[model samples]
Target chain A: MQYLFFLLAAISVITALVVVAAKSPINSVIALVLCFLSIAGHYILLNAQFLAMVHVIVYTGAILVLMLFVIMLLNMNTIVEVRKPVITRILAVVTGGLLFLVLLAATKQGLSVDVPTGFDPGVGLVKRIGMSLFQDFLLPFEVSSVLFLSAMVGAMMLAKKDGTENVNLPPSSEPDLRQAGPNDSAA
Target chain B: MENVMTAIRVVPLEHYLILSFLLFSIGMVGALVRRNIIIVIMCLELMLNSVNLLLVAFSAYHSDPGGQVMVFFIMLVAAAEVTVGLSILVLMKRNTDGVDMNILNRLKW
Candidate 1:
């Protein structure tokens, strides 16, 4: 059982690294899906079966498809090769390493505290979670629904195409692409 | 089932913490170094997942339903964030014809 835990954790970490470092955006998204799957495995091992299913459905099913559609629509499949100064790249790597070391150190000290023995396994069950969600966290749950509604509206407003008529467009906000000066003729 | 729980408990929680930290750091590095905004967004997702892993681990170890419930809330917010973020990216792509982050430096001054 411990071996299974280690194996799943290793797969998740590797796939997560691939998701971050993959050159192609499409490849990165695919790697992210695999990483999420491994995470679901972890959830199952933790006995949160319902959360595991939700993780797979919400992440791998809905979110990944949305990302892929956006990528396809935007035609951003190819890696955009931008040259960054060597110093900044080095700095980023150093900072990331430093953060890892700091976090690892803190976590080592944190694990020294003894965990209470004999946990109730039923707490992670779907029925328990549902009851707690409605009873203890009912207000926050309803508030989250409101948050979702607002996000939906905001997304729609932001994504809507600008009006075709120039009359409605605020003056000087839109750059004039039609103006080609004498400098263009010189070329 | 009891045997499985005992086996899981035998493994120190510190290992899970270290793994999550490493994953989160990798995501941070990608977010910092990558110039493509879409890849940056994906890295952000990676970071969120790493946190989710930690939450689930704690949930199991502590035997608290609250942590798992929080994971659901986190997923909700992550989904909403991705929706808005991708919409903004789409808008940028429509206007700029590319997704390169450096090209966005026009507003930096």
Candidate 2:
């Protein structure tokens, strides 16, 4: 069990680094998919079978594929990203390292809490999570559906061509222009 | 069931925390340094995944379903966020002819 955890952890860390360091966007996306798959492995090792499956499906299946589609559509796969200045890259790495250090120090004392007694291995099962979602988190669950609807509409509105009109205006201001243009035309 | 119990006990929770923290930092640095907008978004997804892993680890350790439920909502929101973000990316590419973040310095077009 320990070996599995270490193996998954190593895979996740390495693939995540590759996701960051790869020069081409396609390579990064591919590495990210592998990283996410390893995370799913971690979930399974932790006995969250439902989460493992969901992670695999939602992340690798949906999000990564969507990213790949966009990359392919834009023909961005062949474009090697222009590197930032060396100093800026170094500064960014330094900032990230500092952030990690702060987080580690903050959690150093808090992470040693005793494991709660009466560990129920079944708590991670789909049935319990489903009940909790439908009962206790019902409002949030329904609200998330509303959120998804709005996001879908917003994405469509943002991505669709607006013809030649309002080509220069941001999306947020374009609606106001549309609202005002009819009045001007009528006058 | 016994196997599951043994598995959870085999590794300390601290290791999970360290692993996720490392992943999060890596994502953060990627988002910061990457010039391409799509790779930046991908790094953001990486950060979110690290958080999900931590939440699930805690949920499993504490024997609580709440954290896992939270993870579900997070995934939903993440999906929505990615949809909108990528659409914006496509729009940016269409209008600007390039997806480089440096070109987006001017707020007004």
Candidate 3:
């Protein structure tokens, strides 16, 4: 189990680095997909087989594919010169480094973790999750459906183009819009 | 509980927490440094992934199923977040023909 976990962790870390480093957006997204897969592998090693599958299905399968499709649809392969000012970039790096260092310091010894040995890890199947969600979390469950519907409608509204803006074009006395009548009304 | 800590293996839990912390930091950096709206949204998802890892780890340590329920709720929210986030990104893309988030500053500046 240790070996399997280590292998998966190593894979996940390397792919995550690749996701950050790759210059192309498409490559970065692909690397991120790989990172998610390795994380799913860790889920399996942790004995959450159902979560492992759902993580892959929901995140890697659905979310990432949506990302990839968006990239392709946008055709954003062309160069987009990064616009961040140098000082801001430096500050951002420093802040990220500082935050990470603080987290590492606080969690350095991993805090005293205790789990009762020999306890059943419980059933983590989809059916079990569904039952709990529908039974105990029923109110929140129904609310989430309404939330999702609103999000979809909001997204559509954001993406849609509104028409019917009347434009008189200044009555176009310019040559391009001038009359094309013949005769000494010259050709 | 006291005796459990005595026999508990320290390595695995530390490792998982450290990895989650690292991923969360990376996501934070991505959010801070990237000027692309879509990429920023993706980074947010990464941050959420790190949170999910923390929840799962806690659930394992406590022998409780409630954290898993929270994880499911987060996924619900995440799915909604991404759908709206991406739609807005697409809208931004159409408006500007590119996704430089700095374009938003024009409204103010």
Candidate 4:
């Protein structure tokens, strides 16, 4: 059972490196999907079945596809290898190493590491999570959803129309009376 | 089941930490080195997944499910982020004709 953990950890690390080092965005996205799947495997190992499935469905199924679409839409696979200015590269790598150290240090204090009691799915299954969410963590969950909804609405508005498009709108002082129904006006 | 469990188990919290560290470093390198916006986003996702792996490992070791619950929420955010990010990427591609981050600095200043 524990060897499985080592295997997964290895898979996750390798795929992640591939995601970063892959020369093309398309290749990177594919590698990223594999990385996500491997992480979901770890989730299942933790007995969080719901999270494991959702991790795959949301990230590998939807998000990676969306990224793929964007990459293809832009035809950015022929990526230009832009030389990252040396100072920026050095700063980024240094900051990244510093962040790793911080996280490790913090983790040493807060992380709970015990030997696994074996892969017991029944222990912390989805039902258990639901119980906890609805019981103790309800308020915070609901508030966060509201926040998410607002973010969605704001994003929709930004996508639909803003000041930039007004420059291209036909110069018609007459208000278009067609703005009546749900679809037309909304779109 | 006991036999199976016994054969494959090794414990050194340090290994998980080391793996997470390497994954995170790779992600940061990608973010820093890659100029294409899409590649950078992919790298960011890689970083998030690295963190998720760490959380799950810790949770499994401790026999706690709460960390997994957090993983769920993180996935939710990542989904929403991708949707919004894709829309923005599309809009940017339409306007700018390329997704290069360097060219996008003009949008900044």
Note the residue pairs that clash in candidate 4. A3-B8
TM-score of chain A of each: 0.83, 0.85, 0.78, 0.72
lDDT of 1 by residue, A3-33 (tens): 8888988888788778766778888899888
Off by over 4 Å in 1: A164-187
Winner by DockQ between candidate 4 and candidate 2:
2
Better of 2 and 3 by TM-score: 2
**Residue pairs whose backbone atoms clash in candidate 1:** none
Better DockQ candidate (1, 4) = 1
Error of 3 at B100 (Å): 0.3
What fraction of the true interface contacts does model 2 reproduce? Answer: 0.84
Q: Rank the candidates by DockQ, best first.
A: 2, 1, 4, 3
**Residue-level lDDT for A10 in candidate 1:** 84
Per-residue lDDT for B1-109 in model 1, tens only? 6665664577777777887898899899989988888888888888898898889888878878888889899999999999999998887877776888888899788
Q: Write the per-residue lDDT of candidate 3 for residues B1-109, one digit (tens) a residue.
A: 3322221244457778888888888788778877877777777887898888777767656656667778878887998888888888887776666788888888895
CAPRI docking class of candidate 1: medium
**Candidate 4, residues B35-93: lDDT per residue as tens digits?**
87888888888888878877766665566667767776777687678667767777776
Count of clashes in candidate 3 = 0
Residue B63 lDDT in candidate 2: 91
**Which number leads on DockQ?**
2
**What is every candidate's C-alpha DockQ against the true complex, given to 2 decimals?**
0.58, 0.68, 0.36, 0.46
